[model samples]
Target: MYVEGLLSSLTRVKKARSLRAASWDTTGRNNDAWNIEPNETRVLADIKGPGCINHIWMTQRDGYRNVLLRAFWDDEEHPSVLCPLGDFFGLGNEIVNSYDSLLFSASTAGNNQFNTGCALNCYVQMPFNKSARIELVNEGDEMHRQYFYIDYELYEQPLDDEVAYFHTQFRRENPCDGWGHEIRVNTPEANIVNAERLAWDNNYLILEAEGRGHYIGCNLSITNFQGTWWGEGDDMIWVDGYKWPPDLHGTGSEDYLNQAWGMQPNAFRHNGSSIYEPDTDGYQTSYVFHLENPVRFEKEIRATIEHGHGNHLRNETSSVAYWYQLEPHKPFGILPVQQRKPVLRGEDGGWLINETAQTQQAEPTLNDEMKQLKAQWAEKQKTEA
Candidate 1:
């Protein structure tokens, strides 16, 4: 059991002392931030605990997706929580939006500026028995000044054996390995012979874990590449090594994020889209939290979603999965800093796919309207000549 809501548990006296680790100026000056050099890993909080982290608040200039946030539980060799600073807060793709959620939120004064104006906060409970080490790795080219507060509680008594350590991991598929988008969806040409998918291997993997854990939620960001509509992909999750026809299967991308026809600008306590901009050629960041209904697994869990129905659309996708599990978690390596940044769109208005220095442009596919405009423009040029 965790002491989460203050108003609900205010009457109960608890045997825990409140504490905080912060980046306040040591000399008591106005410069209350750490100047982290490029490639420097700064230890934000190193706490010994029979305790739980109650809250985390951070803000910095240029602290977009370039800065990495990591947390180690019980002095574990590998990090339990590893993600980009911006993605971990909720949105993705180096985007900043003002949205409020139950467990996570980012606030901006106006215009969504990153320099001191955009404040990121997390309210998830992170319990540890031996030690907890939280860190920030500056992956950007220049030194970044960061300020933060890791507020936690120390308990004289040991935590319950059933308590699970918090964990998170970020993943990305810059232009997912999807089939060509030349054919229109739902047509006979699009639904070719043997269209049925028998394996989940090709789906965009959101999270894969070994050991007992319950998946709490995830934030998914997608930059639509072959855009007419970019969200017909079904969500399929396998729990405990189940075979095909997963235990949890969803209808489509928008439905999985608790949306209907298309993504809209909305933010709710449990599910919502933080950034929904179609004018920017379909950049969407949405999240769904399993606060009341977590997906539990004993041995393993693999969470994924199709790019477009039957893996038919190539798009840039990234996500961060949050869950709680026992120690000795599976080590999932973070992508290099360059690869982690959002992939740039090529001149052809498609993703410039980069996989470990090998760069290539994805073949652009125009929608019906775009194709018509192209034809019209060609005719006009001929007439002028």
Candidate 2:
């Protein structure tokens, strides 16, 4: 009987539990599930399931804007189980620590609404062992359809055995024009020991992160074109500290640090704006930089940019300057070790670019919060051990 009970419990936990129709719109109008308008609103749905729940599905009305989705599970004290949608893709990190449902909003114009006419769907799934799934459907008369599926599975043991690995697969189909879409993976606290971006044959950008306790990785494909011409593209990086003057020639002091760096025409240009002198027969070039230490604290900065233009391209500039967290490591070298294979994968998709990886040690000084988190993670390690 005891064995049967345990097996039943495991089976119950493994199966997904969903919200009943009676509780669909407990907080708002009876529009089936959460009905959000042109403004940002937080909604909650009680998730009841056994075992570690690891997936979430979100469906929005048509014309949604600034849509932010998050998930929190009932684990030891209801700690947040998923990273904020913003921080997931190096886009933005805003912590919305609530045990309820995720956050959603319409665009600034208030013209775009979610789940009104057609369904706009977003999903979050854990790729370890735990699984959670949420889905939204629109019963109204709108002409938009956005649907995505995120698969999450948990391994009994981590890949490296030292850190936990969360593998995510996101697939989306949007038939509307001028609509924006992105898939993000966020780490609540920044402990990215090292991050690298590689351009493969001018088609995709592979973002890789590595460090103790966690590793975040993603590949972003260049699909649409808006402002200017479009084709396969190259990749670029922007450090935190650097600043690019708007108008270089009109600037007061030509002796600016970046100006000085720009004066030296090495294999690559560090600062200032320059156009691809098509008449000059501009050839392809690869740029790479590596910081010595991992970024442990929360900071907003542009890390890299992928230049997508024809041979005679212009208007390329680096705004922010980055200081090597590690000592005088070379900026231009063969792409880092982990990026080579992935670069090939990207090239298969059509981005033509080289790879360079830099390795160095960053300064040892860490902020108080980072130190505290490290300590807590360490304690958790000890308990698990």
Candidate 3:
């Protein structure tokens, strides 16, 4: 569904004011990337709106989980959106294996070569009554060079009181507890045995909130070391105080993400796999945006999934859930930089092969500045604590 930009409904709207905010430097010679200093919070957009954000596009040379992106709507102290910059665009784990979907898409240049450039884009319509502010804070060790464009529409009239605000939140639990490989079983057997055990006592939280709105969708990425496929887990969504048998439940992880059988790294216009690691085995990224089948909620919604049926499979999982909900959202965790970064099993003090470090294909050597800065930051934090 390629939108003919010039003829799209966006520009065709009668009597609406359109605006663009870009990082265009005053001097054309060095006008590209916005050099965002480490530990600095950059205000990306601050605009009064009774309008809607039509599209947002950005790219930066920084690790995904390292740089945090947040947004506040209608002058609320609490942000409506909070997640890793890359993860926010369905590029979790900071690995930019180019992917494209309806609302989110990202790609890296020179795919097979070294020193690849990155491109990220998102198109989620956000409506607000009073105002909207977006911020990006660099939590990485070095300064990040960011380039962005925020496109929005200002309407003549205020938004309807019943309209919901867009919200997105990220969550992760690396290396979730898994039963030993010796006990690993097939999907059918696992489901039957884990049926009752698939209770909500232990499940990955995709989106949890007390509000009235329908969920749009989510992007889920998994890094598994075990040989057993992790799709045995089911999607269980509880709406409005569901206790016995949730209001919505799916057969498996792939089913919930709107894929059948196994998943391939095919990035489609709406729902499909984003990344499939060939160099690193057992890594895959999937995304789905619910347009026609969006789940509605009157009071609350708990979007969750079992990482493995009966919580038997263990692996690294990261996700960003998207939806539009009432004001005053439930709190989203703001993990420290170190905690946000992915970790491996055992006591090894290093990151596994990920978007940030495709070291398996090439050496991911950090310069002296970054090494020293990370060390200094760690020491400073220890002292402060």
Q: What lDDT score belongs to each candidate, Candidate 1 first?
A: 0.80, 0.25, 0.73
Angstrom error of the Cα, residue 86, model 1: value is 0.5
**Clash list (residue pairs), candidate 3:** 95-355
Model 1 CA lDDT for position 313: 69
Tens-digit lDDT track of model 1 for 1-385: 6667636667779889999999998897989989999999999999998899999999875667888999999989999999999889986777677899999998775433333447889999999999999999999899988889999999898888789999999988777766545444554433422122443666788999999989999999887766677777788989998676788989888899888987777899999977675634557789999888999989999998877776666677889999999878999988777776765667887667666733234544444544554455556558869
Each model's number of backbone clashes?
A: 0, 50, 1
lDDT of 3 by residue, 269-379 (tens): 778877764433555678888887899998899888877765555567778899998787786766677756654434462336444432112222334543454455556
* TM-scores for the candidates: 0.87, 0.29, 0.83
Leading candidate by lDDT: 1
Q: When superposed on Cα atoms, how far off is each prediction in RMSD?
A: 5.8, 22.3, 11.9
Whole-structure CA lDDT of model 3: 0.73
Evaluate residue 317 in candidate 3 and report its C-alpha lDDT on the 0 to 100 scale.
Answer: 78
RMSD of 1: 5.8
Over 4 Å off in model 1, which ranges? 1-7, 110-117, 185-197, 345-385
Model 2 ranges off by over 4 Å: 1-31, 37-40, 45-51, 72-124, 127-229, 235-305, 309-385
Error of 2 at 212 (Å): 4.1
Worst 10 residues of 2 by lDDT: 175-184
Give candidate 2's error at residue 50 in angstroms.
7.8
